[model samples]
Target chain A: MDLIVIIDYGMGNLRSVEKALEKASRQVMVSHNQGDVRAADAIVLPGVGAFGDAMVRLKRLGLDAAIKEEVTAGKPFLGICLGLALLFEESDEHGVHEGLGLLPGRVELLPTNLKIPHIGWNRVSVQKESRLFDGVPNGSFFYFVHSYAVVPKIDSDVLCRTEYGCEFASGVERDNIAAVQFHPEKSSSLGLRMLENFVS
Target chain B: MLSKRIIPCLDVRNGRVVKGIRFLDIRDAGDPVEMASAYDHEGADELVFLDITASHERRQTVVELARRCAEELFIPFTIGGGMRDESDIRKVLKAGADKIAINSAALENPGVIGRCSKRFGAQCIVVAIDAKLVQAEPEKKWEAFVHGGRIATGCDAVQWAIEAAGRGAGEILLTSMDTDGTKQGYDIDLTRAVTTAVNVPVIASGGAGNLDHLVEVVKKANADAVLAASIFHYGTYSIAQAKEHMAAAGIPMRLTK
Candidate 1:
């Protein structure tokens, strides 16, 4: 049985992510404890609130270092929505907020012309062949709701791109780390398949 | 570009999906989980489960139902009704609802909107406005209603929408009480009034008789999303059919093949 630890930094609804992962047939545990996180087979960093606040909570709880250690150990780590943005170098959500600096990127507002919070299902175009989207088809609709997105400094980190106003990096991958701007838990069966792939 | 959404709303009472939800494969039509799963498979962009039962125990039932639906269904869903304060909102979201829609409670205490939006991101807080047309001497306008359209608030519908959005509400679910069960069509004027009043996405609800009515709300009223109950509950038109019709009518929609 794959024991997946969902790191909780006191932001958003963590239960939904736990339930979704459970539905994917994985044993899920949502914990803020560093020890539980270290013992997990896989780690999922799921978030739904402001980037700065989430990072503050992560640092306060010392879970940020634990996450880095787990990822450094070559464990499969997945980030969802704001969790994806947190993996970047920095964000300008309210002010300049430093992130975990896992991926080479920065988070910025979607665009002025586009909806402030790009809420709804949009089609994601898979750019490269990665295990994250093993069975999921290209151009599949995924649920997305966010005002900011990650602008990867390195082009090679971009795995999938979705067009809202302009094409944006919807999914990114680097070795054992994978993250998506869309909420896979809320994105129907294709989303579950993505989680299942992550578990495998 | 973001596409228009077709949302199927399920009215849950005592944890059971109320009204006649006639699906050929569903043995128990009143089951909220079954109804939600059916709608998800039908390609509903989102689902809104409104818990009409306001009792304490019944609210828990709704929360339990939300948890079950969230586990089974993959699409995003909002749980509304009986949401009094931030604590109530937390309970629902903790139960796996992606968003919480407050109607009467918000009218009673407008601060709850700001508090919930601030605590649980503005993107997850939806303020639902039930509006009834008010024909006054010089000009006929709409007024917001509360308590399941039983009490009328003197606040102007459009103005209230603006206030709600200003208070950090991510979206507004506007329903026309006059045409609620009439099966005529959505009040395009009311929808447009609210949509234009608020920069946030407005989900047009009530008075959806056919596919054209759905198209009309998005095309004419400029609603970001269209939510229907009876039209979809009684199987007059499936969500896929509505999406196909909207897609052909020059409305951007997510069509699952």
Candidate 2:
């Protein structure tokens, strides 16, 4: 049950996630192979690139099907940053592109008029009780580096909200699948604790 | 609210941490990895490792250093100093550094900024500018410098920042050489000038003697972050202490409590 596979679709910061996961879990593997992903007890998909490019690579590697299958089978799954956005139905990043559709949402530009990329540390204020934030305090700060955010159609899916110029869903949890737009692996102590919670 | 960042920059030479005063008089602080870990634990939002000895031969050392830091530290860290092109940037990104700050290289070929930004997403490309005030007829203007601040590029600092932003730099690390190491305060006019010109986040570097400097740069100059070395290296102020001071001064910080 300790096996945690961080899906590497030939893009993003996979090593940092793997290194961070190693601290929280006994066994962590960053693999592009669908077989390793399917065999894992839990899945962590970490991303940091464009929406359309990531989806293309995932499908090319045949990981898209594997990820959908594993998560549908009730395996605990987590997505970080772009990985969070990828779970949605579609994205309007450079142009309209389809997503995994695992979650009912659309990835759109942060409605904020302030800045393009909401880069820096921001508070993730909790909305609902979820195991993802078990020991972490409400409004704990996490490192964020993205311009777009997911707008989950289902209100209850959001676990936390972060303020830039406008509030956006920063963290979401739907049953066994939980994801965060912020990089937990890049966040400090409290972030590690949240990762530890997910693995445990 | 997205809290203003406090970043501790480590100027490394041959892989050891050193704080440089006015781009000279380098003093050894400690091992880069150990200091980086301590800063990460102390609540630093991010860390920047600049290899002062940024020769092509020594690039491998920094790459190795990046690999070690990624294995040890959790908070996002940036590797800078002497990255000439996309390949150099790609090597460090592969090794583990979250961002690549290009100063001299970007100045040598301004096109490198857009090229690197395009190849490796703008999120990971940071443009570091060493700016010094040049006395002119109409008014004083800050000009961008290169070759470790020894050579001048005649490029107006504020104008260059605007151009860099247009070219796709994720963040601008603006350092005022005049106020650097003086510790009196940050260059408010210079920082404000560039921050106003650039849409991207600007990190005010060089002059941070006390905690109030951090707040001044943020409030008066509109700096998105403040990068310090000597003060934090000598333990003049810890990250938590800086956060407390900033939070008390009405500047939002990443304080869990």
lDDT, residue A117, model 1: 85
DockQ of each: 0.67, 0.84
Q: Share of real interface contacts recovered by each model?
A: 0.72, 0.87
Interface RMSD measured for model 2: 0.9
Per-residue lDDT tens digits for candidate 1, residues B105-171, read 8888999999888877888899999999897557669999998888988988889999999999999
List TM-scores for all candidates, in order.
0.94, 0.95
Write one digit per residue (lDDT tens) for candidate 2, span A1-200: 48999988877668878878888889998889999998999999988889999999999999989999999999999999988999999999999999999999899999978887888888999999988788888888888989899999999999999988899999899898999999888888888888898999
Candidate 1 CAPRI classification by DockQ: medium
lDDT of 1 by residue, A6-79 (tens): 98888876766787889765478989999998999988999887899998999999999999888988988999
Could you give the interface RMSD of each candidate, to one decimal? 1.5, 0.9
User: Best by DockQ, which number?
Assistant: 2
Worst window of 10 by summed lDDT in candidate 1 chain A? A17-26
* CA lDDT scores, all candidates in order: 0.88, 0.87
